[model samples]
Target: MNPAEAGPQVERRNATAACVEFVQALLERKVVEAVLVPQHVPGAKVVVQTLVTDPSRLEDVDPVAPVLMSNSATMVSSLSFQAPKGRIAAVMRPCEINALVELVKFKQANLDDVIVIGIDCPGTYEPKDYMQIITAHGGPISEQVFESLSRGETPSFDGYELREACRICEHPSPANCQILMALWGADFSSGPVIVPVDEKGREAVDKAGFQSGNLPAHRQQILEKITSERSARGQKILEQFAQRIGSIEGLVDEFAACKKCMNCRAECPICYCRECIFCSPTFVHESNKYLKWARQRKIIKMPVETLLFHLTRLNHMVTSCVGCGQCSSACPNGLPVMELFRTIGSTVQRIFDYVPGRSLEEEPPFTTFREDELEPR
Candidate 1:
């Protein structure tokens, strides 16, 4: 049977509970050796990724948490790159899966023994904001978020908004995954729809004993609506952002507050370099070289190369950027790093007709050349 045509046959009352049950089944049935999922911390309101081998440890699991503490692609890379003993299933949001796809292309992650169980994301909040919102509500609001998504609406928290990166995300539904817990246009009263995107996903679902059926008729329609809305919004925002950074002076002014902490690079999942050129001895200039630069320019930013750092990074990874916005979140000075990258990335990606993470078969522009491309007659 075509897995894409198969959907969940079981129904449950609670979406979160249903997901927990499904994941637990994966373990109980030995579909995978371990599962990587998000669970609430014992004494804190924050949620982080946890590796579960024992099914009983999944009591605190919340696969659709509204917070993003860190992009999990780096963690996935760490886990799968070394070729672990057994297969694992990772429950990730759409963006994280997309980032992982890019990492696989760069040889940073191996998906051979991995099963990607993707979840639909309405959007996510910065961790601090999520903590505050949930605290004000007196508990987790994941159910409420899922409910909103089922109605094909963006979930809203009182006194807070989603991260700008999420607000402008074009891909809210999972792709390039084996299994998907589809929420868009769902009747969450019956729980999220479990969708098998390929044969592996179908086998996993069958092994876990979930029956097969057809997906919600309106699921694709609603997903397209959401993507269209976000793409239009993203274009508008990126256009304005590009104008703001249109000139060198403008770009420098926007990034003037950078402390050169490298937090953005450190948090970026696509930046897989073991040692960045900026951190090399070449950039550890001698006092005379600094003096020469200062004398030549007559004036230069102290702790120099801040602008250059951003430019160099953009050159290196812009094509692979998934726009997860961890860089902006990681920035202590609050520079709009995500916006800058997406604005430039969209242009460069368009020129090459490439969308990072869209498919494993499509090569990154930098890694491929075309004889008839980008030439002057």
Candidate 2:
């Protein structure tokens, strides 16, 4: 269910059942060439990205299936520019959608040929950590847990499976989706399943023969209580964590455990680059340069780019950071990547009074200049 919905109307449904019905509708219309979503891949213990072209293949369409797999925005960027495909109906979390919008503004992706399918952010488990739990449990525990959770049960924190970044997520739903798979905590037996955020999606739903009904009380109460609690918790974390890592020196100290492992950037969907400049020979300057730095400074961090990479990367994409939490998820050191990036990203975005992926018409701050704006006071 979309927690962003105001005044709290609870809508509930068996997300799996809704998925089957939704995919069937998409298949019949053929408006989308394929639906890229998650499903159990064969005998694998983890969920993998599956492309469904036929309605029969939509059996395991668990809308609650967490995509803490790989970042999809970079893949979309590559698909948008390098290999243009037919219209795709792909479900993305808010971060992915927002990252895609940033990519489009930066001329990284072409948005005209894709249909966005969004769902409410019910939080997610980190990929590697989640897989570990699945491995320990002999297989994926997602389906069972989701079913239980859907019925209004809060599951215990299963080891280190939950992503650290998710502990503080604020915006969980994609508000700008053309087609939103609304999951209000309301009883699913009588509420809207596929709520269209756009007219095209509305027409599509109408053609699919869906009828809206009154939301349920039980579902609404669950959503409101949960989201409200989440927001308060997030604010507290911001305040507490801020006290520790609020300055440049403190920031570097917080990142002291990073081991120069570019895992964070590597996992970030917005950090899409076939050849990172830092990874190039230009950064691999003569050996004497390192010695000179060591001679001058007394010590050189082994990975060389201990501070520059993080800072530059933050500067480059903070305006586009969508708070997907994948960076911290992919980190081996468990550094709070989303917390730092989003904290800065939020400031940068607000400077322009912008929210990424919320619109296509809005240009990025770096791309276009105003003739007469932000004049001297």
Candidate 3:
């Protein structure tokens, strides 16, 4: 379902400042033990995730910091694992929120103790694209890139900064969360902008002393303008990568440089295996085995069992991929891990007529099956 079409309608404006205040209020009200948001380091404008135990830290709350290298989903899971059993309210973009939901379903996380603050993602730049923008803009970053220029109806980098997967994402606004930060006002247009996705989110806003205002039509127009442009870019990407998605051979070829680094699995929010079979000695071969392969095939695939390795993983968790893109980020060889997994994940999830992370009660595809399904004599 379209994110915009599913929620209670309301108005919003100048939410950037309101959001910061809301986080501070959550801290004061003890709604969360800490507020997980990004902050600007004094010397460098590079915004990193900061766990705010005190409301004062919200002064640096910059939700717009571009996150491509790290997945906020993984961050949340790791924090949940390591931190005390207190409610941790985290500010996340749409994809991060969805990833966390999927993680909860996989038993890798618990959402009962967390307050999610979701934002309307305009999109982000790839790692290099962001660096390039910083370099060209004379170091550090200004609010102008995401806060202003984009609202002016022009992306700062002509699609250079957007990750491959985000360009195709049809759902830019968040549909599920305890709180959806309204960005309806403070932009070019005059109309109603923000509203709650559910009763829980609405209550949070109300508790923060926020009453609904007119959501600006210009804000939606801004979103649509970006969406249309990204759609064109997404179509270009599909055509460019079409052949690669055709078969396993194409998929494998795309990973030709993969060294089985397992970084993808490591950074994945949903990968909860304390001990993975691929990481086990079951797949490890001695030097003799590598030499033996060289003798048999003249040249061995350096990683060994690369295709089998990935397929084994695909068999296990392809249906639960939330497309956080951390796998692609962790790939040292620059494999389009997100593209391959999402392509396969979409197909896998569809088999069970499911959308990963949409709801908690839904069982995974492999966890259940119809008795008469797929019967062929």
lDDT per prediction? 0.88, 0.67, 0.67
Q: Candidate 1: lDDT over CA atoms?
A: 0.88
Per-model TM-score, in order, reads 0.94, 0.83, 0.82
Which has the greatest lDDT? 1
lDDT of 3 by residue, 209-310 (tens): 666555454666766766777667656665557566587778778878888889988877677788999878887778798888899999877778877767
Per-residue C-alpha lDDT of model 1 across residues 208-258, encoded as one tens digit per residue = 999754577888888888889988989899999999999988998999999
Off by over 4 Å in 1: 1-13, 375-377
- On lDDT, the stronger of 1 and 2 is 1
lDDT of 2: 0.67
Worst 10 residues of 2 by lDDT: 3-12
User: How does candidate 1 fare on TM-score?
Assistant: 0.94
Q: After superposition, how far is residue 330 of candidate 1 from its true place, in Å?
A: 1.0
RMSD, one per candidate, in order: 6.6, 6.8, 7.5
Task: Compute the lDDT of residue 83 as modeled in candidate 1.
Answer: 88
